[model samples]
Target: MKIQHFTNQLHLLKEDESTTRKGAFIVLSAICLVGCLTFVSLAVDIGYINLVKTRMQNAVDAAALAAAQEITNAVNTAPVGTADVTQYSRDQARIAAKDVASLNDVFIDKQIDVIFGRRSFNESTQEFDVTWNASPSNVVKVIARRDNNDTSAQDGKLKLFFAGVTGDRYSTIVAQAVAYVESRDIVVVHDFSRSMNFDSYFNNESSARLSDSQIEQNLELVWNDLQMPNTGSLAFTPQYLTTTKSDYGVSATVTFKYDDLEVTSAGEIEKVQVKYTDNSYQTFNGLSGNSVNINGSKNIETAWVTARGPSENEPVTVTNNGISVTYAANRKSATMSSPQRIRELYVGFTDNSTDYRSYGSNGPYNASYSSWKEMDYMYLEVLDGRSYWYYFNAPNGGNEVTLQFDDSNWEVKQAFGLTGSYPYPRGSWDGFINHARNYSEFSSRGFRETYGGLTLMNYILRDYPGHWETPDLWKTRHFPFHAIKEGHLLLCDFLEDLGFDDHLGMVSYDTSHRQEKTMYDSDPNVPSVNISSEPITDNYQAIRDLMQYKQAAHYSYATNMGGGLEDGIQMILDNSRAGARRTILLMTDGNTNTMDSGASSSLPHGWDWDELFDYDGDGNSDYYTNSSQRRYVLRTAYDAVQNGITVHTMSVGIDADRNLMRAIAHLAGGHFIDVPGGASVADMESEVEQAFHRIASFVPPAKLMNQD
Candidate 1:
């Protein structure tokens, strides 16, 4: 009985131990299960976070790029203050960032943390440096936040799926991006040859000439506001010598040994300026024996002065040659007719501004001025195979007019003929009138503009942003040059708006090449090409004026495309800034039919016309013909490529040497933007603009930069 009892106790103890083991195992299993689920949740949350991070990065990058583009557009549109530009850039950048962020769940925590700034290379550190709020705002920065740190940011929280369900959620992500704008320099080579006239625009089936009345009416369509200058200014058109400009190579040789030399005598007024109380002035030259004819241009005020011949008191002279000019006499008084009210008068030489008007708001100082010789003739006469002009005084009888010279009580009044110098030329100027009638037929294509109107200054006054002349008007006008002028002017406006760093230049080609001059003639009839080799300039207004008033050359009419390209290359080499991207835009409306005499030497060794026609054993093919004239043009393009210049080609009508242009573009690493060939004026202008805009397109809007 004792043995059996002991065995029972042992069995009980073993069973109890087994039960304890089973309980411990169950607890361990539970712990292991919990750990495995926790790990799985963490893994899911991490993957989601990474995915959100990637999305955030892409959003920020896109936002930065949009903002950067906005800055460039804002700058290229209108003239605004610097503060406005900065604010606009920032605003646009922020708006863009928010827009993109909304789609990508990337939001800004603070406005200051996001924006554009100057991103430039740091020479000292050999790395790019970022300056916040710096001008030029070439760089844009964007931020994406989802850390749930800032409530104002409204950053979207990430869903961790299974992880969130298990309360092991971790939703946070932040992304940043920086992007930058590019810089460049461009030159234009325009084929101003006569053949460009034959483009489809001018190659219309009808050759009917429109009447003057029709032209005036049509000209009126291009402008909205135009007020004529005071025509009652002077008694005579001052005739003088207009110094013609020579090519750059020649101009450089004729260096000015001296100009402002110390006058051995009391120094005649070689040139005198009148600082008018108002924004106006007059000018006079060639001072000999106390006599000089003077004329003035009207500005905001209306003041007329007319002196025919020498009188007892010839208005201005070197009386004392004192520190300032003083009128020898007091004020000169004048009586006016209705609507012919006197605004201001300037005695260009007599420095003492004290000589002013009376009973006219105490004209403490009316003004002082110097005379300028303006090309004011209606017709250009070629005498002895050279352009010449003859000036004669033929004052017409009219209502007695009083010219002014007033001071204190002494009103220096002189009676001069105030005849007709408006609407129509009225007077005893029979010589000029006869010459004008001689060319009244205006058959020459060169007389297209002058066939009717006086000047183009009245037409560019329109607020035309997208409107150019219609095809119907263009076809009826039969004016191809006019079409080009209209289109080129638009390009001028486009270039004018380009950032400050860009420089502009124009080269025209006919039988020769010319770096155009700034023309201010009412008729622009004189020789208008000179000042060769002018480096590209930022003065867009000056360039526009040159294109506006400069007339077609009657001397030579061949298209010397090679000359245009050579000079255009020179302009770039002489002026472009260091480290700036270089480009050449060649615009031609016809095939190249002419080249320079040195065409063979100008080309590369293997690229010369060819040895195919070498009668002599010499390497070069003897003579080049008109057929291969385009090859030389193509060769010049190759030269441009060797110099690292990007060459773009443009053509308007079917006559454009498209194949040659295409070849040139291919060889020189550029695009051949074919402006459709035809009478579509609006399309032509639009094409010209697009061509230039395309050149501008090379500048990337914004690109992502590595972040730290």
Candidate 2:
């Protein structure tokens, strides 16, 4: 009976232990399952938040960039310093930010804020700062925010899918971006002229051929010639004499020694002799001592003087010892030391400048025997049966010398005349006018065309950033390459570098004699070689070649500033080039000597030059009558401003019309770049380089100054 009772007790104890173990196992499994669920929820929520964060950040970045772009557009299209422009810029920025945000598929957002201001980086503190000034803000900042539990439509709140079971129902995300204006488009107008051939400023004779006396004056030589007191008569001893034949005629170079001794008493000059290398000689007689005239007077104590006869019947004289040596009227003579110098380099225009008259005679203030004679007078003679003007330089002494003709050392280059084709006589005012006329003729090709104008343009454009092996641009927004045609890749890259949209054209104008011949109205010969109104094109070389087509030799060399402005506007307004920032570069080196109003009677964009000038409406232009074409240019520029086109003007050499360029720039809201090519070759080249670089420089890509 006892053993059976003990077995039942053991079985009951085993049952109790089994029950405890099952309960503990169940509890542990429940805890593990809850922990796994919590972890899974956290992972899912965190991943969703990260995706939202990325989308928000991208949207904000796009919005900021858009705002910055809007600012650039405002700068390009709006009139500078106008309140309307600032306001429009702000509005555009806001609109752009919204549009970009939506396009980026950032619909579910709590709020987006776009702010415009000035942002700068502080190097000292290594931090960026923002200043609020919307009028002309350079920076655009955007912020996007989202928070959980808001549950509002498009609130950007993340709704948790699994975290809800863990009592976590919401999450928040926010993104911020800052962008600044980057890149700008600019156009440059350059002027080319004949004077540009000169190495230095106008009338710089430092580098020209000069005589010993001239060299002394320029400090290029020492004045070591023999000097004699005024106590005796002037005397000359010929040393070397030679003649050379040229296309013009025979020319002579004579070297002689001279003494400026005073003539105290009257003495007869027995004879005057001129000897040549060929054993030929000439003698003058019947000249009495009392008949001697010193300069313009026959007064006593007049040792030596150079004097010209009052008329053809008289003669120029140099007196010594009561004896006068005379050169017949129209004959020019000089006295000097050994080695005669070449005076004038090449004869140029000197009206209202020097005493050079049309008949090749010296006027007032030109001493007959001084250096002026060498500079102003050309010896006229017949040699080898041909007529020529002998280039002469005055000697450095007062001794009298007769003309000994030689033609051995004659040089056509030393003989004054045009250098190349388009021959115009030199040494006279008429020749200058003739040469100028030839330059104006369209068919005339000269150094100014091939080497001056075209060469400068080629150099500036060839080394331009566009032709670089790699496109120079910042990495941002990828430049929306899809907006450009495939054929325009290079052009787009260039325009991008220039801060332009690849909408560029050329408008060339030379004054035309025809009343109706004007820009656009007249046919631009070989239109295929001309640049047409178009969008960006990859063929930059082709455009450069087209620019070269307007060679300096082209017909119509007159500067018709109004006509150029006319065509320039038309090009900017062309239908194919619409939606681009319009700009024109009006460059010139001369006054507006030719112009035509055309039949339009109105300026571009419905403006009227007549309205600005013809206040009386008398059917004639009136305002700025002194500068009719100039007035018309300003009027056209006003129209350009109204039509949102910028016109930048460049003045080259001293002769360029600066007032006109300034007026155009002011009226069209563009900058004036005075390259001042007249300064020097180095200065002109440096200015050109700097000007192009300054115009091409653009604001860098907007930076994320501050982010959250």
Best by lDDT: 1
lDDT of 2 by residue, 1-708 (tens): 899999999999999999999999999999999998889888988888888889889998888887887766654455656666566767777888878888886652323377777643333764445676534576778887776455775654777778788775777777888887532222323222222222211123323322322322211100111121221211221011111211111111222111111211122323334443344544445444423321211111111112111333233333321112233333343332111222322221113223332322221222223222323223422121333334432222222333222212121112222133321111222332222222332122221111121221122112211212111111100101111111123333334333322334444556532111122312344334323323223235544444432323133335666766776676555432322345666776557766684623233465444544453568654433346676677777887787787777766555667766775776677777775542223344455545544343333445555455
Error of 1 at 55 (Å): 3.3
In candidate 1, which residue ranges exceed 4 Å CA deviation? 1-51, 70-96, 102-105, 108-114, 118-138, 150-173, 192-500, 514-550, 554-556, 569-579, 601-626, 639-644, 652-659, 662-701, 705-708
Give TM per candidate: 0.45, 0.38
lDDT of 2 at 96: 81
lDDT of 1 at 408: 9
Error of 1 at 141 (Å): 2.0
